[model samples]
Target chain A: MPTQPTDQGPLTSQFAGDADMLELLDMFVSELGARSEQMRDLLASRRMDDLRTVAHQLKGAAGGYGYPMLSQAAGVLESQLAAPVRDLGEVAHAVAELQSICDRAIRGHRPAA
Target chain B: MSQGTSTHVRIDAANLESTRPLVLAIDDSPDVVRLLQVRLKSEAVEFASASSGLEGIELARRLRPAVILLDIEMPGTDGFEILRMLKESPDTVQTPVIMLSGLSSAHDKVTAFDLGAADYVTKPFDIAELRVRVRAAIRTFTLFQMLAQRAQIDGLTGLWNRSHFDRRLVEEVSRHARHASPLALAMLDVDRFKHVNDSFGHPAGDAVLAGVGSLLRKIVRDSDVPCRYGGEEFALLMPDTTPEDAAAVCERVRQMLEQVTWPRHPEHNVTISIGIAGAAKATQLAPEAWVERADRNLYAAKSGGRNRVVWTSIESPLQLNRAG
Candidate 1:
């Protein structure tokens, strides 16, 4: 079982001893990866509106799933995409950081016996 | 850490997905296209081929490939003419082109290089050498893009730093002025952030900043711009959002932050005070005026026992007001 931070929301504690935490984390990671790919495609196509939409979804989902780091990175990326023409490097960096966090979380959240 | 042979370049696997080198191959010879395609087939590359210079130009315009392999010996429109056309077209000029030719003469190579060909590869080229050059070109282009991205990003939080915020502000304000769209600015400050640093150290402060950053991202729409204005202070520019709407978003962020559990220091609760200002006809007012109004309201929140959202509007004569 994963140790839940006592100060966090009830959901965090509910998933602590449950066997479902691993599955939830895996689902979150897969979703983030897919969303990241979609954002990258939108950005490369110069479709700022689509990119912003995908990034905004990622930001919201990551936050709701308790992956605050990924959410923060996605938020920054979402804002950049919202601009008339986003600085590509800024978006890339934010995406890179988001990927890192998602990867780390996926690695850390292992199912308990 | 060896001299010129250093393989210090970190290949991020995630970026390699859509960021794979997009190569545009322009040659009249199908054989040459197949040969080059075979040589460049790697995990990090995608190839788009055009049999004529005109076709290449069209593909280049549409696909915006990262690099172009142009055969200088094409019949109707030779590589030089194509190069000229490519350079003339603003859309394709920035796309790097590599000249492919049977002409090994120094003069031909020099002319091709002078005509803005990134490099010249002689016909019957070493397949290995061609692969190396293609990789090098892609690597250089990617590096240039990374440098461009770094310039606009906030080094700390990786947010769209202040300069980008300023540019977006000017543009949004101009659009609002033209369309009379409502625009709101929310200036957020972490309540007692210095104390977080003092008690838990800078790492914990960083954690809080990261937390706040994520929280703000959650409550805003995709069209809104959230920026790290400066140390412990962030700003959000909400285009087409009314003051009431922006306040609702900021208030949600405030509540979210208040709920975040600080790692290793659960007792040290975090809170944010937001100052929101909006203009229905913001184009009439300068960008700084809107920001200043939001900042003043933020100050009001801080003075009035923090952890609340304060808002003001161009329509409201009331200096600035706070709500719990």
Candidate 2:
């Protein structure tokens, strides 16, 4: 399990004080909630293909939404999923790491008001 | 990373229409599109978005925007495929594309570059940096358009220059020959142009040339191509025109020149000798030969009188006059 970063300041600043940034941050949080749930369900069911699809989407989207850590985690998990032989333990670990990053980023960027 | 940030700030989606050159963003993520809209708005760049590669391709074809920001990952027709399509299309080939992807790997970057991306920007792009890149792309595109315009236009008369005229003549001649359609070539020379320069000064001579150039542009049909063939000489390539029709147009030009109110030589008048050749009379000959035929008639016009049109007769090879 990756340690959760205590400070949300860096993530919040990514919005750059723009209303469109806030909207994107809100969208990111909403999408993260849905995708994190889907990821957990897919991981628990051992559906590597579906789980990789979710990871790939996050890999492309997270960084654009100002969540680089989540993008990195998702990218790693996606690559691991692509391996011909995947270790269940490693795949589960990568999924958990991605989930943690998503949680932190969503919490940090979501609108305060 | 969300610390020391102000809350409640807003970034509206940039307006679709503006004086700025358009910057199209093709990304599956709505969030990225919004992000781009906000960041690029500072540069006064207009925004257009597409959610898929196929949609992007269609939008690109229609808009022909100044630049494209393309995402590498999409449901269908992915970024590389879209890039290939854009590069292949004649209309969109000149548009600069900046690849937006989360894949920061050297291989991915190299692949995008190889596929004709103008620049590859990794995800979580810096707004300031993106703005700079977009401006640079616009600058490059503008420079290319200006250079292309310069190449096809005459510097002095704003008419099609000799080279462009030749190219158009070749194209029109080939088409006319292939279709057996009517086409005519007219050659005109200012009478006593050297005397005009010697008497009044080069500026007056230039004014006369410019006046005639503008007049040719104004009087000719839309299908006619008027070009400054060389100093004191002008050529008109008229497609879908008969020998009689071409002579009429040339005669109008000759009369217009005689009536032009010269600023430098108000008391003096300018005159032009014109020669015309119809495609029906010279269909079997090459384009150059056809032009030479017009030149021969031009010589006849000059020799017969300095202010008349001498045209080749289709029925008989004998030269005829428009105003005898």
Candidate 3:
């Protein structure tokens, strides 16, 4: 919570153009707020295991949803949490960056055909 | 070539080769499962997901899905272990399984392959690539199934051929033996089949044989395996059926045979003489001996009359009881 995450530019998913994924993308965007809340709660409770699971899930899901950057941020947070030499500070910062991307992700981003 | 067999062959082939293949995904993460459901949604295949290994395996066994998308890092039984178990089980052994994992390590890939995984897809995989891979797996699986069915199916009778009969007899008998389940075998001979060929011409004889095959297909239970033993001879293997129950089935077929009016040869009624032999428990007799007993009873039926059923238990006194 101490270090503020810098903006990482626009957050339109690369898969926005894909007709099959557009519906799923909408669902993912709708769920982002709740997902962010859950991650924050998990981090607050110091539930590193549950937090890593959430990150791992997001890492796998976001990329398919066309948000590769969000997926990458989650993957970084997951890796930090999995590391044996735990840096709680770096882990906290990674979580912030992932959440920051989630916040900036605009709903109904037009497909780049 | 019989008129009815081609349709039966087509039906059997269609059953084996599903038009819309079922694809199963076993992932621990709900998000991953949901993404897969959406991504793999296509007209050519049905998608089912299980958030745990146990449920996934159960679905795989029940559906016999053409292809499986298995995730490696599951909670209870990991994908590698699940793959091993699936490969070991006969029911799901032929199903193509693609391992999905976040770990891109060669060691993990090697492990998945060693455990009998058909393909490996790392996490955040390209959507188009996954779709192509799944289609490829389904094509491979359905083709394999069709080839296997063709090998075992008889061209004329629409029943399993002799080779399939030989293999299935051994397998079913052994299975029943292990389970101590009641098992029966009926050896059927088309009475005066040579006369039909000599009198009504070869085409009429072919029609008669096809009729018998059709009748067998209609009469036998779904669990029963009916096979064309050879020309004018057939065998039906009935699992979990006693001599009495098998005789009832034979009698029903006989009655149905009376109703089948030959296309060209209406005057000549095609009759089948069935000889049924069964054991209370399959463990009592060997498969060959059991078949021999059924054949003996069939011989008795042929001698007793042209269109009668003869049945005898393996443990019964040396007497062939004809049940008309």
Top candidate (lDDT): 3
Docking quality tier of candidate 2? acceptable
Q: What's the TM-score of every candidate structure? A: 0.52, 0.70, 0.76
Ranking by lDDT: 3, 2, 1
TM-score of 2: 0.70
lDDT of 1 by residue, B44-86 (tens): 6777787778878987887777888888865467789999899
Scored against the true structure, residue A50 in model 1 reaches a CA lDDT of 58
Winner by TM-score: 3
lDDT string for model 2 (B242-320, tens) is 8888998999999988998898999999999998888563366678977898999899888987899999854367767
The sequence of per-residue lDDT tens digits that candidate 3 reaches over residues A1-113 is 56554656767887777787777777778778788878888898999887887888788778878788888999999999999987988988888788888887854365343
CAPRI-wise, candidate 1 is incorrect
* DockQ of each model vs. true complex: 0.01, 0.39, 0.36
* Candidate 3 Cα outliers beyond 4 Å, as residue runs: A1-5, A8-10, A15-23, A44-46, A106-113, B1-19, B166-183, B190-223, B230-232, B239-245, B248-272, B278-289, B302-307, B313-324
lDDT of 2: 0.80
> Lowest lDDT 10-mer window, candidate 2 chain B?
B1-10
Instruction: Give the lDDT of residue A40 in candidate 2.
Output: 90
After the best TM-score superposition of candidate 1, give how far the Cα of residue B304 lies from its true spot, in angstroms. Answer: 5.3
Better candidate by DockQ, 1 or 3 = 3
Q: How accurate is candidate 1 locally (lDDT)?
A: 0.73
Candidate 1: which stretches are off by over 4 Å? A1-113, B1-20, B26-44, B49-64, B71-95, B101-117, B123-129, B147-152, B164-185, B195-204, B217-225, B237-245, B263-266, B277-297, B300-305, B310-322
